[model samples]
Target: MSFAISSNDVRIEERDGHTYLIASSRDEDGNYNHTELNLDECLGNNEGSFNWSGEGFTGSAENIHLSIEGPEQLPILRAHLRDSEGNTHDRDVNLSERIVNDNGCLVFQ
Candidate 1:
């Protein structure tokens, strides 16, 4: 599913054995700057829930892509996916920043 963040809202998506959290803001140029988080690692730990945070931007969705990050902050990009309740069956995803997209679609970073 899709979610809208009123320039300051945080968004979370859980789907296909994974969870995605994104914090985004708009820029004067009308481009979205997004900070994304993957819950697979935390969820794999069997933790009930986890929190995520990131910076903000000031724009809209310029492009969509899947973003993957490792412990050292390495990023991997891919397509997007649809999020569903089954995705969160094992863990809870939380967001501390604003999100613009919450769908489970694979988005290439």
Candidate 2:
């Protein structure tokens, strides 16, 4: 129902060579509802900025930057979003655990 605002609130999962970016939170029923994005389709390179807006997701982000660094090229995401009420939020997430160094290429695992 809301945006995932921290590294701890986000999770990356790899399945059948596809990488998924997931965020979850509890609903009014006390059940966890998940929001997922397919990174393989949206993420074109190691580092770039993107914007996403739609229904069933949270706030619309005007700027969502993704970058990879260090020896292994681990991922880091910074997002700035505006909610329906015009409230703004900024989020920074370190997504290193799901990224693996395969030989020299950065692969999602």
Candidate 3:
């Protein structure tokens, strides 16, 4: 499997003096997954796009995409990636409340 970051959906912003790029994924089972990659680590080179290809995910490889929105009091970044089956990924995470739920596909606190 190969992964490519779309330049059209990519975003970069600074908050609290730090930059972050929010990434997410969705699996064939309609499960949504998400992760945050610090700009300093992933975008240190300041490239306009990111692409990679290697060993396929051993277990389940979920479809992935990324979004960037911040530099304000409340950062709302939304990823529009889909899975192999074309299921949209959406998750709401509230750090302050320590609550997370992804359309009933995932739950965390």
Best by lDDT: 2
Stretches of candidate 3 exceeding 4 Å from the true structure:
1-10, 43-109
- Estimate the TM-score of every prediction: 0.29, 0.34, 0.27
lDDT for 37 in candidate 2 is 58
* Model 2 lDDT tens row, 14-91: 555555666554444555555565655543321222322212122244355565546544457665655556665676
Better of 1 and 3 by lDDT: 1
In candidate 1, stretches whose alpha carbon ends up further than 4 angstroms from where it belongs are 1-7, 25-32, 45-109
Arranged by lDDT with the best first, the candidates are: 2, 1, 3
TM-score of 1: 0.29
Per-residue alpha-carbon lDDT of model 1 for 1-109, expressed as tens digits? Answer: 1233323334455555455555564545665566556644332221122223221110111122333334422223222222233232222222212222334322322
The local distance difference test score of each candidate is 0.33, 0.45, 0.30
Residue clash pairs of candidate 3: none
Ranking by TM-score: 2, 1, 3
Q: Give the Å error, residue 109, model 2.
A: 9.0
> What is candidate 1's local distance difference test score?
0.33
Candidate with the larger lDDT of 1 and 2? 2
In model 2, state the lDDT of residue 66: 60
